[model samples]
Target: MDGNATIGHGPDRHPAAWNPARTREEKEEQGRRKEERSPMPPVTIMELLEKCKEKTALCDAREAAHRIKNDGDLVLIDVREPGEFEENPVPGAVNIPRGFLEFKICETCPEDHAPILLHCRTGGRAVLAAKTLAEMGYRNVAAYQGTVDELLAALE
Candidate 1:
């Protein structure tokens, strides 16, 4: 259809028609309807990173290892594959690989609100995992950046 032509089927609809006699209340109502239909702004990667940092729950691999060794309260979740975890993992870390994390963590963990420290081969997968966990209402979650090897070296 042409830009100036009305497309919808109704007596009240007119594409090129503008009601100059609309009252202030009517204008306000139309503005409200338009605002309600507008899409929300997209969240960027930088925003996510900053949020993770501000939450105070995010930690590096070395810090996570220390927490697991001393605090013993946080859940150490290795988001790497089973094969990778079998080769080596941080001491006392549970193997809930990235693919199965959503299912396994929610099922097995006793407390939905418990603090969890997640790590993958590197930081990338852990960030994604942490985001997922946070979205699922796990308030206290952290992502460990370093891989198993780096963690082990730091421990030594």
Candidate 2:
């Protein structure tokens, strides 16, 4: 079709004729306006966490501590940032930030049957991380679904 030809109807039901050679900024502005006209509904953190939890296993701090004490092969991974881990570290727990988990997990825990326990400041990141590991084909993985303080207290 020609540059001036109407392609289809836009959100306003008007014949929309977007220039094929439109600048990037012009296309971005048009997309922003369209999104503003019909914004998507928000997804809450709790909702997302619950969904992730369903797809992965969950272990409380006390259970994790007990397993660590008994199971010599269990790998406890703290999925918090370096600064947070440095400030309040969990003994015997390795620091693998959530952002780097996918890249670093294989080297840290190669055996698929090895038990993995993931934790963060809150339950959200841990569960999400667990779900990711599960999807990555880890056989035994669990997220400590509690606050860091609770985990520390239980560990002690």
Candidate 3:
């Protein structure tokens, strides 16, 4: 884990390199080859965010609040940092930072089939969190692209 630490068995452990012993020139060549081999990703985070958002079940602020209020099987997750949650927490949401969501989701809600609604400061992180949960075999998931505060504000 040092500055020059490589993983497999070579000098280049920068994560993208396949062979560690390859020199810089060789590594650059290898990287180019890898790029040619694999398809490229979206140009920006917005594109990825859009994709994640499209793959999920969406709920506006009202629907999300209603679901949390009435659905016993629903779990509302606030994917914000501790400081953000403490400032003005979502009514029924459990604070789980986006970084730890993949690791902590199962422990927080073991019922895979139950609906889990995810939201963050804005819409982007919720889509991402929902996507991650879906990828991890969660059956029922929803992403409130609008934050809980947005919903509450509309009510007022």
Measured by TM-score, the strongest candidate is 3
Give me the runs in candidate 3 sitting further than 4 Å from their true place: 1-28, 154-156
Per residue, candidate 3 scores C-alpha lDDT tens digits across 1-156 of 555544555554455444445677787999999889888754699888877777889989888778877899789898989998899787778989999998898789998898898888887888898899989889899988676578667444
lDDT of 3 at 109: 94
Model 2 / residue 62 / CA error / Å: 1.6
Please give, for residues 23-87, the per-residue lDDT of candidate 1 as tens digits: 66689999999888989766788777666656545676568768777875778788888888888
lDDT of each: 0.77, 0.86, 0.82
Among the numbered candidates, top lDDT falls to: 2
Candidate 3, run of 10 with poorest lDDT: 11-20
Ranking by lDDT: 2, 3, 1
> Model 2, 50-105: lDDT tens per residue?
78888888888788778868889889999999999999998899999999999999
Q: Estimate each model's TM-score.
A: 0.62, 0.73, 0.75
What are the runs in model 2 whose C-alpha is more than 4 Å off?
1-42
Model 2, residue 64: C-alpha shift (Å) = 1.5
Instruction: Provide the lowest-lDDT 10-residue window in model 1.
Output: 14-23
Q: Clashes per prediction? A: 0, 0, 1
